[model samples]
Target: MSSTETATLSVPGANLSYTVRGSGPVLLLIHGGNGDANVYAGIAEHLAERYTVVTYDRRGYSRSKLDNAAKEYSLETHSEDIHRLLTELTCEPAYVFGSSAGAIIGLELACHYPGQIHTLIAHEPPLTHLLSGDEQVHARHIQENLEITAQREGIVPAIRQFATLLGLDQSNGSSGRPNVEQLERLLANMNYFVMREAPAIRRHTLDLETLKTVWNGASMRIVIGGGRASYGTFPYQCAVALARQLGLEIVEFPGNHLGYVHQSQEFAMRLHIALQD
Candidate 1:
């Protein structure tokens, strides 16, 4: 097994905590809401065999500290953070895998810095903006109701609903045993994710024209990934819409929305194949 090394990068408004394992070309893993660098621990070991797998805590998540306690989160800000991380770590274009809100951030990063990314496998980005008419309205309505749940009912009930929204099966949950410490941290992040991160994701709009131009050329290969078990879910539907808009096929992975956690080994294998192709 490759020895994991921990590090930090100083970025605008925050000091990002990151990890690197194995060697070769860089492969950065960006986590979704309430997830930190450690979220990718299971799959990073497998991927590390072929690539220098990098994972980081997005600002205000865990070890990553925000300069301002109340710093506003946005896709553009998160994207810029990733750009800086890649720029600091590698001179060559790097491979990026971002799931959920992280995927949305990846799209924003690719849009702004096409030269910094080799290939981006965006898994289940909740691009409500891409949905048409009623679909868009419905998705936003669900999100709004979720906020109300979080505010009135509390984070626990809201999280359960959030899980349902992502098409996750509570019974199956994670493939590996849950870590008590990690679960506590996730619980702690719940309020922030609901009050801040979720809203930021909703407000984000991708530059479709720029993305189309980049996908048309060879500067960067953008692949949309959706979990087989997450079919018909809002995020999966959003992924399908994205692939259609880009004229690319949506690659199916194992498990549901939290596939990387529940189906780490299989998800890693699928991701490796996608990156290779």
Candidate 2:
């Protein structure tokens, strides 16, 4: 049997909209930056079979709106939103699976509120703390691209830079697939979609200062690098560093950065295994 339901969660005056699919234990699927929880549509629907998949748009995006009179958005607020959503559900400890920036937010959730998560599968989180010289360079490169977008405010170069950071640069001869067209389409849509609400994500990030404040307090699974080729990439390094800091084992899932997109089937399979484990 397959099904989907939409609902609104009232948190501190904000009416947060979310969707639920499937049954069994709850698993909150959080999306990364430049995306809504819709990005997990492919996997969430399937995972719903064995899990109560929860996906929602971050406040200030899509259907969710903020009740608090905060002008700016921060990861701290985002983390609290998740906390309130879970609390309202009477589900204090649900398994959480997040990717990229969403993974960073999940980490924040665990830190901000302890024992609030059963298991968290952080797939290729760009935690940045584990970044080395080359990884730092790539990060700066992507940030530069974003700065360019903020300056010229055009999303094309930024899109290309995104592909580059995800190791999709044509110069690298990474893949035979055609991504330029897809990237172009993504940029065209963003102006009306994600880019329109830039302030929601403006200037916010996961840094050592923030992590140190919460890492020791929160119990979490710090997932990191696995593949032979991914030895020194940002995510892998982040996994290593986070595991060391948290004294947790590095759990390997699937892809490098955008595993859910690049290796969807394998990514989903690994994610399933991770959650099950």
Candidate 3:
């Protein structure tokens, strides 16, 4: 393993925090929601031996800060912030691995600015276009529940719902043991994303038009939801759809939506192999 250091960086609109570790090719590690840069800690360390892994807290999470002058943050701004980070750090176009919402941002960045990214491994983006009418309505309804829970029941329940929605509530999974206490702890800590960033999150919309416009010529691959993940889940469905539209093939990685957490070593090895030339 390589030495690790927690580093802070700033872009024009937001103050960002991340960890720079390892020592080879440049790789940007984007966290989904909840937690801080630590979400990618072990994964980054695993890759650090041969990659300069940059894992950071997006504007509103952990040590990163949102600027007072900014009129709320948008996904475009987040991607731009990352672009700025890459420019500050390396000349080589970096490989990117993003999960869940982070995956969504990675796709946007790759699409909007093709030359900056070498290859993007997007785990899942929760897009509805990959599904049909009934399933689409189901996903929208879930997003609606998140809105309602955050608004009506307070951030705690909303956080719980978010975790449960991602299949994190039951570590062994819905089929095995469920840790109620650990679930609540994560829910409390992750409330900031659900409350402060949820609104901005919904604005992300993907369709055939957006795909053609945004990701047309990008080097992108979607990692579909893996085994043990619910077969009828949104993330899996979304990956399937995005892969089809990109006219690229789908690759399977370890674990479910939270694979990076549930199976860190396996996920890391799979990640290295997936992005390996």
Candidate 4:
């Protein structure tokens, strides 16, 4: 196994903690939901064998300490942090993989700072802005309900509701044991995610015009991806909608939303194939 090197960057409102391993073109992994850099540990380890895998805890999550805990989280700030990290870490443009909310952030980065990215694989970005009429209203209601639940009940119940809304709580009878440490870390970050990140994500609107400009110019290659089993879910639908709008192909990965966690090696292999020369 390649040794992991940890570092910190003093960004605007937070000191970001990140990890780097292996060596090749820089491939930065942006985690989603109640997660930190550790969420990509398995995928990073596999990808590191061929590429320099970089993973970081977004502002106010895990090891990334925030200067203002009460500061409202926004997609702009999240995207800016990624741009700063890439600019400080590499002279050349980097490949980026962003999951869920992280995927939304990647889209923002590609739209605003096209020069900083080579290719971006945005996996299941929950782009509610792409929806229309009834679907949009339905999505809004779900998010609003989640916020209310978190405020009234707590993070755990809110998360359970979230999973149920996405239909992820259904039993598949898979026998793998959960990682206790990862679960604890995820639980610890739930407060930040539920109170701040989720709201930010819900309010964000992707600039389709800017995205079209970048894609038309071929300045940045954007690939939409989703889990095969996650079809019909909001995130999967969002990926499909975005791909349809952009006239791009939607790449299917191994498992559901958390595929990279349980099927990391398989996901890594498919990811490498999708990113091949």
Candidate 5:
């Protein structure tokens, strides 16, 4: 029988709703765009057999609500929240798995609070700053345009544009569509994600010097991951660039960007292998 528990944590500016399942070593899962704790439902279920999986709705998303909804979000604040949660949950270091924007958060945490994470698998972190010249300029342009669209036309249109810009609109190898219920939940959080989180992601820059210093210390293992079908996408390119910077190899996961959602079983199995390696 599967065991589960839910709880709330008071963070800097938000109240986070999180779930814990099964038992063993700690494994923290951070959701990406238009997602909450439930995003890892399938993968968590499988991993929970040997890992105490922890999943949470990030600040200002779903059940995790901000004290000041109008407050601007930043990767620093998000990483701090994760630190606080880990402090409260256990003294031992934990494994972390993050996708997209959440992967960015993991990078921040690894940079700032290295001792808290044992191994961090950051899948498809959209580090636009890794790009160069015209590519960097083009990526920023899209982000700025998306922010403007979200503010002017609203989230629905902004989301469509985001999909098209990321090439997620393509039917082949497209991240499978969310079910109607999941889509509803995503739509509900679109405003927060597009208007708040997306802008934060675009503006944030990684501190390579600090990252290198930490990596040299060998305090924790950092892995960059990309999906097989996510080639040609900005996030995948970003992952590739980051791996080159760190002199690390890119770990390929199953499916596309949202493989953890669409191919949870395979993703879970692959994740286990990745974590071991």
Candidate 6:
């Protein structure tokens, strides 16, 4: 097993809680909505064998505290936080793997600081704008409904709906089930996630024109990944559309949307291969 170390970094508006394991080139894992670093537990353990794996609670999630009153945040803000984190950890460019909304953040990061990343594996970024006319409209409608559900029915009901939206409701939770403590933490985080993070994700637009310029000029490689089990879903469609836009192939991985949580070992191995490529 790899060794583990946890620490906190104070960024401008928040103190970010992060964990490091193993030793090698850095591989930062950015989790999606309602999840903290704990979501990557199994995946980190496996990846740490070959890389210094960094998992962190994004600004308002888990132990990472906001220093002031809650305010609307943007994808660019999260990207800058990560930029500071990468600069603090290593002088060399690092690899990044981001799931769902985290993947959107990674895309934002790559756009602004292309030189800071060696390669970025963006797995299932749910950018509705990437979809076609009706598809995009329908996706946004679902996101709008999710927000309304969160506001009217509270976090639990909204989360249940979100799970269904992401195809996570189909999970038996056999491998992905959180323990009591983790469950409690996740539930707590969902409040901020539903109210703040989800909207940030929804509002973000992938500047494809800018991204093309970056991709053509930078050394950074962006790989889009989609889950095999998640095929035909909203997120998977977004992944496909993103790949099509970027002229990159969509790398299929094990399990569903939350594959890193449920199929961690296999996902890590596939990820290792993707990173090497």
What C-alpha RMSD separates each model from the true structure?
2.1, 5.5, 4.5, 3.0, 3.1, 2.1
lDDT of 5 by residue, 1-277 (tens): 4699999999878899999999998999998875688769889999999899999999888788889987768888999999999999989989999999999999899999999989999999999999987777877888888889888998889878977887663221224687787666677778788877887888789999998898788668999999998887888889999999999999999988888877889999999888888
Candidate 5 lDDT for residue 97: 96
> Residue-wise lDDT of candidate 2 within 129-228, one digit each (tens)?
3656776677555555654664585665655555566564222112355388645534443443335333333344555555555555566444433433
**Candidate number achieving the greatest lDDT relative to the actual structure:** 6
TM-score of 3: 0.85
What's model 1's lDDT at 251? 96
Question: How well does candidate 2 score on lDDT at residue 158?
Answer: 59
Each candidate's lDDT (Cα)?
A: 0.87, 0.64, 0.71, 0.86, 0.87, 0.89
Give the clashing pairs for model 6: none
Error (Å) of candidate 4 at residue 184 is 7.2
Q: lDDT per residue, candidate 3, 16-74, as tens digits?
A: 88778888888898877756566677677678877888888887775676676336657
lDDT of 6 by residue, 152-225 (tens): 98888878887887678433223557799767777778888888888878888899998889988999889999
lDDT of 1 by residue, 59-150 (tens): 88878878997866677898999999999899999999999988999999888888889999999999999999888897898788778999
By TM-score, is 2 or 4 better?
4
Cα deviation in Å at residue 113, candidate 4?
Answer: 1.2
Shift in Å, residue 92, candidate 1: 0.9
Model 2: weakest 10-residue lDDT segment is 169-178
Candidates ranked by lDDT: 6, 5, 1, 4, 3, 2
Error of 2 at 207 (Å): 7.5
Candidate 3 regions off by >4 Å?
Answer: 170-189, 207-230
Number of the top TM-score candidate = 6
Which is the winner by TM-score between candidate 3 and candidate 6?
6
Give the candidate order by descending TM-score: 6, 1, 4, 5, 3, 2
- 1 or 5, greater by TM-score: 1
Candidate 1 positional error at 176, Å: 8.6
> How big is the RMSD of model 4?
3.0
